[model samples]
Target: MEGLSEKLASKLHKYSVLPFEDMYGTVSPLDAFVFTNYIFFLIIAFVATLVFFVVAANKTALVPKGIGNLAETGVEFIRNLCVDSMGKEGVKFVPFIGTLFFFLLFANILGLIPGTLPATGTIGVTAAWAVMVFLLYNYIGIKKHGFIGYFKSFVPSGVREMGPLGKWGMGSFIFILEVLGHFLRPLTLAMRLFANTFAGGMILGIFGIFVVLGVKEISAIGLLSSGLSLVMLVIMYAFKLFVGVIQAYIFTLLTTAYIGGALHADEH
Candidate 1:
């Protein structure tokens, strides 16, 4: 068990990232830029997403069918999510949010395939996405209400209304805390996606190892344990599929909420 644990620990990092040279056994100029397994899968996801949408667009009809229907259904889901989170203003963001949702959904699904890594399972990929979201909502807020006005919204209305001493004391402290929390949003978003997907992959890998080890043992007990592990792996794979969809929805939902909050900061 200890040896198995050690082996699992050593192999688990493969789910995160692997350099081009390690993967292909040849050095390339791209290696200097840190091209990796996750990045390769990320590009595949991006291209797949682009092709899906393009095909869907070309195949659209009054009564959508097949890929068109699936595309329409996905778009409607994202549109509703945005509207519910941000109201009418959210409609304008449907394109961005929808793309993000589908990309993540595809990435997660692709990772389920043998020999492919989940792009979002990597911290760099998730962090890049979260940073983009952070920059976007903040930019929207700044554009809607000038830079000064947008930042001033960080302080609670009640705090700003207090007496001079109260305003400078409690208000400043709250403002600082709020700012810190705001900055932490990207970190939370990145970590949440990376941890969930990466952990899911690791669990699957560990179970796979167990199945292999069980099969290698020559006893009847070995066969029974391998069968049990196989069943559990199937169950876990199904759960991971559900989790992938939920994570994509969650990330998109939070993004819309953040944008909505920025759009209506004065309301709070």
Candidate 2:
């Protein structure tokens, strides 16, 4: 028994692992947590969105009752967003934009749930989604206008309309600035989502710790601390829900705008 225990300890000593780890940490996004719970939350968001939409579709009421009304409202909202941002041409991209919005909306709200991790809090997850939008707009641009024309579209119409000397000089300067700005969009989008989600999670976590610590003692100070922490936690959760929805709308809005700009560079 002594020999076996020693061998087991020796073998396990070579690897460091978190208690929550489900597999080797190297392959997972959080790495230290192995297969982080955020992946499960992502699936939950996806399934919830799918099931909700499916049920809403099947239960159409003449007066548009319950989830059906919500479903209709959601579609109409997206339709208006697309039309406003990219004109009628944007209507065709609604499904894609809507999917992205709902996934994010659900993921953000999921974090407020007692034990679920927000997938958007993970940098890798946000980066992946941001890259998706980046590729999508680029593809749409290229498809709508040939590859060369798409690159040319990056130069604003004002530049092209300028006198030859101004076009070659001031236009080139403006074009370079515009290209650099566009290049940073993906990085900025990913960071914006990740930072906000992570910050919200951190606030909840810190207050949770205070609540735990305060509840351990029977003193008035302890009770006061616990009460404060609990109150703040409730408030923060509500605020985070609002933030999540706003972030989702912003992401979807930006996506449609990007696609619109790509498809109709001069006009948009």
Candidate 3:
């Protein structure tokens, strides 16, 4: 079991962010600053996403087909999510939200390839996305309502209705809690996506190790175990695909909800 664990760990390390010299045995002055597995795959995912949408756009017509239909369906899905979560005002955010959704979806799917790592599996990547979202919604809020008004919205209406002393005391307390929760949003978003993607990859790698170990044993028990491990690997691969799609949707959904809340904070 320990040996199996060690093997799995070594396999998983290949997917981690490492310097170009360490990962690819190449030496360059810029390697330490800009070259890493994470950045390499991220650029691949980004370029792939850009090319897909561009191609889809060119293929657009009154009656869509093939990739055009797939692209339109994806657009409609994001459009509906935004509109449902943010109402008519959400229309303006469709492009940004759609880009986020497709980029994440492509990244997650790309990782399923035997040698690639999902960028979202890294905390740094997910954190960058979460921070971008945090800044965007907060900026929208402050733009819609002045800076003071935007901050003031953190206090509940009931707090304002209390007696003078109670209003100040309770309002201050609730305001602090709200501010803390607001700041924690990015942390939670980053951790959720990172944990799910990283853990899923780990599980897949473990089962893969089991299959390899079983194949090497060569006895009756070995064959049985190898067969079982292969089955589990197939099951896990399918499950990972579903999880990839779900995590992408969940991230996008939460982003839309956060933006919507900021856009309509006065409604609360």
lDDT of each: 0.87, 0.79, 0.87
Model 3: CA > 4 A from native: 24-32
Number of the top-ranking candidate, with TM-score as the measure: 3
Tell me the tens digit of each residue's lDDT in model 3 across 1-268.
4377679768777656676456755334345465777777888899999999999999999999999999999999899999998999888899999999999999999989887888788887899999999999999999998898888888877778889998999989999999999999999999999998888998888888888888888888877988998999999999999999999999999999999988887776
Worst 10 residues of 1 by lDDT: 23-32
Rank candidates, TM-score, best first: 3, 1, 2
lDDT of 3 at 46: 97
The local distance difference test score of model 2 is: 0.79
TM-score for each model: 0.92, 0.83, 0.93
lDDT (C-alpha) at residue 252 in model 2: 85
Candidate 3 backbone collisions, by pair: none
Badly placed stretches (over 4 Å) of model 1 are 2-6, 24-32
User: Tens-digit lDDT track for model 2 on 96-196?
Assistant: 98889988998898777876677788777888999999999999889989998887777777777889988889877877887788878888899989889
lDDT tens digits, residue span 81-150, model 1: 9999888889999999998899999999888887888889988889999999999999999999889888
Better of 2 and 3 by TM-score: 3
